[model samples]
Structures are given as C-alpha cells and as structure tokens.
Target chain A: MMAARRGRSAGLIRLALYGIGLVPAVVSFVLGATNRLGADPVNTFERTLGLWALRFLILSLCITPLRDLTGVNLVRYRRAVGLLAFWYALFHLSAYVALDQGFDLHTLLADVTTRPFIILGMVAFTILSALAATSNGWAIRRLGRRWKALHRWVYAAAICAAIHFILSFKVIRVETLLYGLVVAALLAFRVYRAAPRRAKAPPV
Target chain B: AVDLAAQPGPLSGEGLKPTPLRDVTHYNNFYEFGLEKTDPAERSGDFHPRPWTVRVEGMVAKPRTYDIDALLGRKLEERIYRMRCVEAWSMVIPWIGFALRDLLAEVEPLGSAKYVAFESVVRPSEMPGQGGVLPVLDWPYVEGLRLDEAMHPLTILAVGLYGQTLPNQNGAPVRLVVPWKYGFKGIKSIVRIRLTDRQPRTSWNVRAPDEYGFYANVNPAVDHPRWSQASERPIGAGGGFFGASRQLTLPFNGYGEQVAGLYAGMDLRRDF
Candidate 1:
C-alpha cells in the first residue's frame, strides 16, 4: 500500500512540474498583449524565459541534494525538469536569433564565435542536449553504468551557465554574485559527499 | 515616429522620426536608477525633481545656481535628433530644450575653459543603483565634451520630451542631448555644469576605460570591444510585435552634415 501511494504521489508531482514549467510562456503572452513587457518586449520575453530556464536547471540540480540530505527524493521528475530547461534554452536562443538578430545567420555566427559569454551559453546548452538525449529508459539500460557517469556533466553545464550569466551583464550585480556562490556551494557539496563513498568503494 | 505632415517643412527637413513615445520613454539605460530597462520607470517615483538647482561653476565668470523654472523660462527650441546607445541600439527623440551654447553664454566661460563637464544628481536613497548594489561604476554620473562640441548648435540641454515635461526616468528638469554621440555622452538629471581646462573623467570611461572613451562619438568603423557597432537594433520598429530591424549605423548617427566638420582633421576610428 505504501509503494502504491508513493507511485501515485510521484505521478502527481510530475504533472505539477509540467504545469509549473509551462507558466512562463503564458505569462509572457499576457505581458505581450497588455503592453506590459516594457520597451523591447522581445528582449523582455527572451530574458524572462532565459532566467526561468536557469532557475529550472538549478532546481533540477537541487533535487539530488534534497534526496541525499532529507530522504525526500523527487528523482522521477528530474528528466521532465531537465527537458523543460532544454526547451526553455532553445526558445531563448530562438528569441535572440529571430527577434534580436533578425535571422541574420552571419551576425548570429559572428556573435557565437566572438562573444565569450555566448560561446559558454552554447556549450552549456550542448551539454544539456547530450544529457537530455540519453535520459530515456532504453538508453540507460543499454549504456549501463556509463549512463550514470555521463549524467554528471550537468554540474559542468551548471558552472558554465553561471559563468556565462556573470559575463553577459555590464556590471557584476550582487544577485549575480549570489547565484555564482550558490552554484559553487552546490558543486562543493556534491564533491564532499562523493569523496568518502568513492574512497570506501575503492574500484570495487 | 514624429508626424512629418503636421510640422512645417523646415522642421520636417531637420527632423528624424522620434521612436514611439512609450518605447522612447520606457526603454532606458539610466544606470543611476538600476540596470534593468524598467527599473528607472518603476523606482524613480520617490525621486524629488522639483525646485531642482543647477550649480554653474569652474572657469565661468557668473557661477550661479539656476532653478528648474529659471532654466525653462529661457528661449527654448525643439530639436529632433537620433540618439544611439553604446550598446548598439538607437532611438530618434524629439527633445525640447535650448542649445547648450545659450547656457554657456549665460555663464560666460573663461578663455581657459576647453571642456564642459556635466554632473548628475545623486541621492542614494532614491537611486537604487547608487545604493552600493554594484559599485563598479562611480556614482553621480559625469560626462564631458570639448568646448566646440559644447558650443555646437545641435547640442542641447534638454528639459522635455514629445512636447511634455520629461518624466523622472527620462531625466526630469534637465539633461544633456548630444545627437552626434552615443547616449551615455548625454548625462541625465544634471545638477552641475562646470568649465575646465582638462577633460573630465566620464563615469563609463572611469569604470572601463578600454571599452568606453571620453569622446564616445557614434562611429561605425570603430566597434565596441565586446560587440559589433556597425549596425543597430532600432527599438519599437516591430509595431507591437518583436522585430529586430537591424539598420546600418551611420557616421555621427547620420548627423554628419551638422557635426562631422568638427572632426574633419581628426581620425574618427581613433576618436571612437
């Protein structure tokens, strides 16, 4: 009976995550309609979605800590959250290229090559794509332990994203600094937690 | 866009279309308020602009504090000009104000005055950005122009926008409007006008001298170290939808006829 209840709760949680993930697009549309996105609505929409994408990525990373520290595992929804993050990032890139750059491939190519922050963003998204593609049960079963090891790239993706965010803005704001600190702490926590267990296992 | 049909031919010939009023007023980069575009519009409610006084000092014969009303009482003309930002965005604004030359005339600048410096008002309590959130930039924004740039007919100390008094976020009471240069060259909420022999240290130049220079003229040849300046994303061109409308940037922002002669002998690529 307890197992059945756990399964039901996990399904409900997944539904809730999907609902939450889709809220930003609705909010952006309403904002656009009411002329509330401020001057440069495209920029506002793009920035808002990009921020939401980062938040979701951070939240997805937080789930593992929540499980290990408090035994409140939300592991089943991680893939869904990760995929949402990827979709948001894709849309953010679309906004930049279509709305900001006006589909100028030359300009977009120039930006990706020349702008260090843009290159970092592109790298983070590329890593996320790899993780998302291999997230299925079939891929996991086929790859065996390799799947678990490769998924660790998320941490690298998170760090790259944090650095990109910091470098993109003109000023290193307090909020941006706080975000970088949080990413650092999260990575440090993962390392500290893993070292003792890896030492005990000692190559099997 | 400014209604060209409504205005006389002489005014129409000189005028470029002003960006949509909402876009022109709402989208801002006044870092004194905050970095976000909407921050100034939202956070400037508490800023007190009335009874504002501007102290004219330095190499001037008559250094005095001119009230907002006193400045408004003088003969003013409407100037419609292009404003380009250092961030590669451009806007055409119809600003209402008198030429800076008129203000300089009042002060009677001394022979030694080679540059004119403008200082913005600073109230940390009101200006959220100045509250030490990002101390990267020096507070009380400062910008300077050569004596000739200061005296140019196109250079105006603006007081209003779109036929109305400027909103606080739009630099209420007074601000500098130099059509030929990047937007940062135009300091907002000006409180002091000083004449000096040496070039004043502008806010952005002090923060990142390599990226921002003293005379930040709009030149397509010289790009910002971080981004391309050859083209600009004109805001409000999308017509309530998202449009990029990247247009080729003009030398001196298409005001070469009036201001290009000032830099005739100087290399624009280096000056930029």
Candidate 2:
C-alpha cells in the first residue's frame, strides 16, 4: 500500500513539473499571438522563442549533474524536461516558419539551404523531434537497449544548436559565447564521468 | 577655444554644397536606441530635448555654455548631404543647421587645440535603452575628429531636417552632421564640445578600438571585422531591391574634394 501511494505521489509530482515546464512556452506563444512584442515583432517572437527553447534544452542536459550532486532521484523527471525542450523548440521553429517567413516553404527551404547556420538549427530541431517522439514508456520498452543509443543524439543536437547561435549573429556578442562555453562544459562533464567507468570495466 | 563668431557665414548654394535631393536619404548607424536601420526613429522619439545646455570647454580661448534655443538662433542652412553608415548603408538628408566651424568659433580655441571631441546626453529617463543590463557604451556617447576635420566647411552642426525643426529621434535641437566619413562619426544630441591637444577617445573606438578607429573615415576598402564595407543600401529602397541600390560607396562618402586634403600623405588603411 505504501509503495502504491509513493508511486501515485511521484506521478502527481511529475504532472506538476510538466505543467510548470509548459509556462514559458505558453507565455511566449500568447505574447507572439497578441502582438505584444515590439517592432519587428515577428523577429522578436522568433528570437525569444528560440532562446527559451535553447535554455530549456540546456537545463534538460544539466539534469544528470544536478541529480548526481544532490542525490535527489531526479532521473524520473528527465523525460519530462526533454519533452518540454522539444515542444519549445517546435514552437521556435514554427514562429520562424509561419510568422517570419509567412509559411513560404520555398523561401524557407531556400534559407535552410543557403544559410549554414539555419541548416544547423534545422538539423538540431529534427534530431530533437525524433528523440521526443520516442520518449514514451511504450517506445522505451519496445526499443530496449537501442533507446539509449538513439537518445545520445541529444548531445549532437546541443552542439548543433550552439553552432547555429554563433553563426546566426552578424557580430558575435559575448552572451552567445558564454552559452557555447556552458554547453561545452556540460558535455565535457558527461564524457569525463563516462570515461572512468568504461576504463574500470573488464574488456567487454 | 577658437572664436567661431569671427568666421565667415556658413557656406551656401547647391554647388557650394552637395545637392540635398539627389543625395541618398536613408543611411544611418546610431545604435544606442536599437539595432534595426529604422530603429532610431522609433526608439529616439521618446528622447526629450528640453532644458538642454551644451558645455563648451578645453584648450579654447574661452569656455561657454549655450542653451539649445540660443544655438538654434544662428542662421540655418539646408544642405543635402550624403550619409554613409559603416554597416554599408547610405542616405541623403536635407539637413538644416549652421556649420560646426561657427560653433567652434564661439568657444574660441587656443593655438594648442588640435582636436574637437563631442558628447551626447545620457539620461535613463530620456533614453530607455540606457537601462539595458549590458554596457552598449559608457553612457553620454562620444565622437571626435581632428581639428581640421572639425573645421571642414562640409561639417555642419545640424538643427533641423525636411525644412522643419529636427525631430527628437533625429537628434533634435542640436546635432553634428559630418557628410564625409561613416554616420557614427556624426555624434547626435551633443551636450559637450571640448577642444584638446591630444586625440579624444570616441565611443565606438573606445568600446572596440580594433573595430572602430579614431579616424572612422568612410572607406569602401576598409571592411568592418564582421561585414564588408564595400557597398551600402540607400534608405527607402524597397527592402533591398537590386536595381534601386546605389553603386559602390565613395571614399570619404565622395566628399573627397572638400575634406581629402586633411588626410593627405597619411595611410588611410592604417588611419581608418
């Protein structure tokens, strides 16, 4: 009975966290729709959504370090964070397509093809969407060990996102550089933590 | 300070100055307010220019403070001048104002005065962008030019535009309008003018000295670190329509005839 109650409580806690995670994305969408954003509103909306999407992705990536340090048992929350990041990323891309480009698929395709930065951003979003699609428990059970391999693409997505930001600005502002550095440090921590465990294991 | 009052009347006539109409009316580089090319108009409108006084001091024979109204009392001349931004955009504005030479003469520069530095008014209440978390500049924007550049006949201290009083966003009441060189060289809503022997540090040059030099001459060949400076889009062009765009930007914004002698024998690439 106690175990069942704990499971129910965990489920409730996750639902709350999921709702909280959607706030930024919801607010950004409402602001974009209401035209509350200042002049060049479309660009403003696109940039704001894109930045928040990247921030959530970064936060999702930091969960492992956070859980390891705090021993908070936060692993159960990883799927929620990853899914929210993907949702925000979808909104970010949609803003770019529907608002900025007015759903001009030809222009959009041309932009992705012509601009290396846009291509990088598109590739990152595509990888994120694929990961988000396979995040459910059913897919996890079906894929078994292959699920972890597929999820590793999140690292590639983060790298691509950082590159997308650097190449997007005509003049490189220090803010973008700092974001790149933080993402690099997070990835480095993951690699460092994994290397020792692999080295200690008997030849596999 | 040299006495600007004794100088001859500000230059007049279309031939004596560039034709204001044929001149491009679109290029500008004032970024304190925002980043878009048209951002200055939207962001700068909120700037209130009342009860403003410019402090004129340093190496001049006399230091004086003049209110905006008194400064505008001087004869206003409309000279259509071509303005080229360092970011590769150009405009022709029919600027209304007296020459900077006239204003400098009022301050009375002494023999030691070799350069003139100007400062913009920086108040958070008036400039909303000043409240930004990041340091866009060291507040009270600054621009400087060699004494010769300051004295150039083409250098006008603008007071109005479009035959009307200057709009607040366009640096109303008083602003420096240097036809040659990049638009940033023309500091806006000036509140201070100091004549000094040493070269004064300019805002952009101080912020990123490697990118923006003290001279800041409009050289098509000298590219800004991030973008090419070889060409510019004229203002009012249809969202960068091809045929309507201006040809290659001229050196010193094509005011070489009036101001080129000032930099004679100097390496423009190094000085720029």
Candidate 3:
C-alpha cells in the first residue's frame, strides 16, 4: 500500500512539473499579446524563451545530484524535466528562425556556419533533439546498454549551452556569472562522484 | 504628448515615423544606470539633470566653460535621425539641437586640434551602475571623433528630444549625436569637450579594441566579431507578434551622401 501511494504521488509530481514547466511560455505569450514586453518585444520574447530553456536544462541536471546527496529519489521525473528543456529549446530556435531571422535561409545558414556562439548553440540543440527522440520506452529497449552511453552526451550539451549563453551577451552581467557557476559546480560534482569509484577499480 | 506633437523642425526624417515616445524614454542603453533596457528609465529617477556646466579646453583658443543655460540659448533645430545601435536595433528619434560646428566655432579650435574628445559626468551616488562591484566599464564614460567628423553638418550637440528638455535616462542636459556612426559613438551626459592632436581614447574601444573602433560608422559590410551588422530591427516598427522585420543596415546609416566624403580614400574595414 505504501509503495502504491508513493508511486501515485511521484506520478502527480511529474504531472505538476510539466504544468509548471509551461508557465514561462504562457506568460511570455500573454505579455506579448498585451504589449507589456517593453519596447523591443520580439527580442525580449526570443531571449526569454532561450533563458527558460537554460533554466530547465540546469534543473534537469540537478535531479541526479539531488538523489545522490539527499535520500529523495525523483528519478522518474527526470525525463519530463529533460523533455521540457528540449521543448523550450525548440521554441527558442523557432523564435530565432521565424521572428529574428524571418526565415531568411541565407542569413540562417551564414549564422549557423560562421558565428561561433550560434554554432555552439546548434550543437547543444542537436544533442537535445537526439536525446528527446530516444527517450521513449521502445527506443530505450531497442538501444539497451547503448542508451545510457548516448544519453551521457547531455553533459556535453549542457557545457555548450552554458558557453553559448556567455558568448551571446555583449557584456558579462551578474546573471551570466550565476548561470556559469551553477553549471560548473554540477559538472564538478559529476567528476568528483566518478573519480572515487574509478580509483577503487580500474576499467579493463 | 503635447511636446511630441509640435510642428516639424527645420530638418525632416525623410518621412520615417518617429518611434513612439513611450519606447524612446523607457528603452535605453544608458549603462550609467544599468545594463537592462528598462533599468535606465527605472533607476534614473534620482538623477538631477539641472545646474550643469560644460568645460571646453585643450587645443582650443578660448578654453571657456559654458553654463547649461548658455548652451541652451542657441537656436534648437529638430532633426529626425535614425539611431542605430551596435546591437542591431534602431529607433527613429526626433532630436532637438543646434549644430555642433556652431558650438565649436564659439570655442575656436586650434589648427593643431585634429580630434574632439568627450567626457560624461560621474555621479556614483545617483548612478548605481557606476558603483557596481564588477565595474563592467570604467567610470565616467568617454568618446571621441575626428575633428572633421565633429564639425560635420549632421553632427549636433543635442540638448532636448521631442521638443522637451532631455530626460535623465536619455542623456539629460547635453549629449553628442553623430547620425552616421553607431549609437555608441553618440556619447551621453557630456561634461567635458577636449580638443586633441591625436585620436582620443574612447570607452568602448578602450575596453574592446578588436570589437569597437574609433571611427564606428555604420556599414552593413563590416560584421561585429560576434554578430552581423548587415541588418537591424527598427524599434516600434511593426507592433505585432514578430515585431518589425529586419531592414538592411546602410553605409553611414544612409547618410553616405553627406558623410562619405569624410572617409574618401581610407579603407573602412581597417579603420572599423
């Protein structure tokens, strides 16, 4: 009975996470519709979407550390959090394409190829897309052990996204410092977690 | 509302509609206040724009200090200029000011004066960004222009916008407006105008020489190392979902006919 109750609660929390995840986009839409996004609404809209994507990506990274450091197990919701990040990233890219670039193929190609920051952003987005595609039960069963190996690329995607955020701004503000520091800390924890186990037993 | 509705001034903005007054006052890049677009308008309430004085010295004949009232005595002409920021956004502003050449004539610049250096005010108590812990930029922002560029007919010492006294967030009291250059070249809240023999140190160029240059004329061909300069979105152009579509940026910001001769044989790519 306790196990069943706990599972139901976890499922409810997962549903809550999805509901909360969409608030930023809904708020952005309402603000845009009401003309409350200040003077440059389109730029504001584009940047807000990108900012939320970063936030969700960082939140998804926190799940593993949360489980390990504390006894709280929220593993079931990790996929939901991660897919939220992917969807937000998709919206961000769509804003850049439809609003910022006006679907100008020439400019889009040039930006993706020549701009270092844009290149990094695209790299991160590509990884997220692959992860999201294989997140289903059927794909996980088909890929078997390789699924774990493939999903590890999220670390690379997170690093690229952090660097991309840093490079996109003209000046380094406090928010940039905070985001960079958080990502650095999370990645450091991963390294520290792996180093002790590796020292105990070397891989053949 | 009444101020913006005044009669058209001596110069026109080529029939381009002025950006809404709300956007003009609220959205700004005044780092003295903060980095956010709305920070300037929100945080500059404590700033006092009155009781100002500008000192004109260094390589000038008279080297006189003019009170703000004296500077305001000159006949103000409204010239609608399309202000393009280096960040790839723009606004059509109806600026009210007299020719900068008129102000320079009063100072009587010496033959040796090849450049004009401008210095902004320093008031950390009032301007919170100046007191920021990180010090993103050096205090008391500075800018410069070639002597000929300063004396160009299009350049002006703007004291007002939309027929009213300049707002604190929009470089109150006095500021420089060079239509051809990117908006950073148009320094704000100027407290000092120094004439020099060599090129003067500008704030942005001093911070990042590779990204910003002394002569920052707007050219679509020259891309900022991080982003393209080929196009810009005019603020308040289209009021809907996507806002305004990006319009191609023009050489000399479409003032090439008036200012291109200023850079005759010089290569813009190198100077930029």
Best of the candidates, TM-score:
3
TM-score of chain B of 3: 0.96
What lDDT is reached at residue B205 by model 1? 90
Give the residue spans of candidate 2 off by over 4 A: A1-204, B1-31, B35-39, B239-246
Q: How close to the true structure is residue B149 of candidate 2, measured as C-alpha lDDT?
A: 88
Off by over 4 Å in 3: A1-5, A197-204, B1-9
List the global CA lDDT of all models: 0.82, 0.74, 0.88
Interface root mean square deviation of every model, in Å?
2.7, 9.4, 1.8
Candidate 1's DockQ: 0.38
**In model 3, how well does chain A match by TM-score?**
0.92
TM-score of chain A of 2: 0.89
User: Candidate 3 at residue B139, lDDT?
Assistant: 72
| lDDT tens readout by residue for model 1, B41-103 | 888888888879999899999998899888777666677778899888888887888888988
lDDT of 2 by residue, B52-115 (tens): 8989999998899998778767776777777777756566677777888888887789999999
Candidate 1 chain A, run of 10 with poorest lDDT: A195-204
Of the two candidates 1 and 3, the one with more favorable TM-score, higher being better, is 3
lDDT of 3 by residue, B1-272 (tens): 11322345555558778899888999889999999989989999999888899999999998989898887776778889989999999999999887889889988999999999999999999999898867778878999999999998899988888888789999988999998899999899999999999999999998889999999999999989888899988887555565568899999998999999999999999999
DockQ, computed on Cα atoms, for candidate 3: 0.52
Model 2 DockQ (Cα-based): 0.05
Among all candidates shown, the one with the greatest DockQ: 3
Q: What is the C-alpha RMSD of each candidate to the true structure, in Å?
A: 4.4, 9.2, 3.0
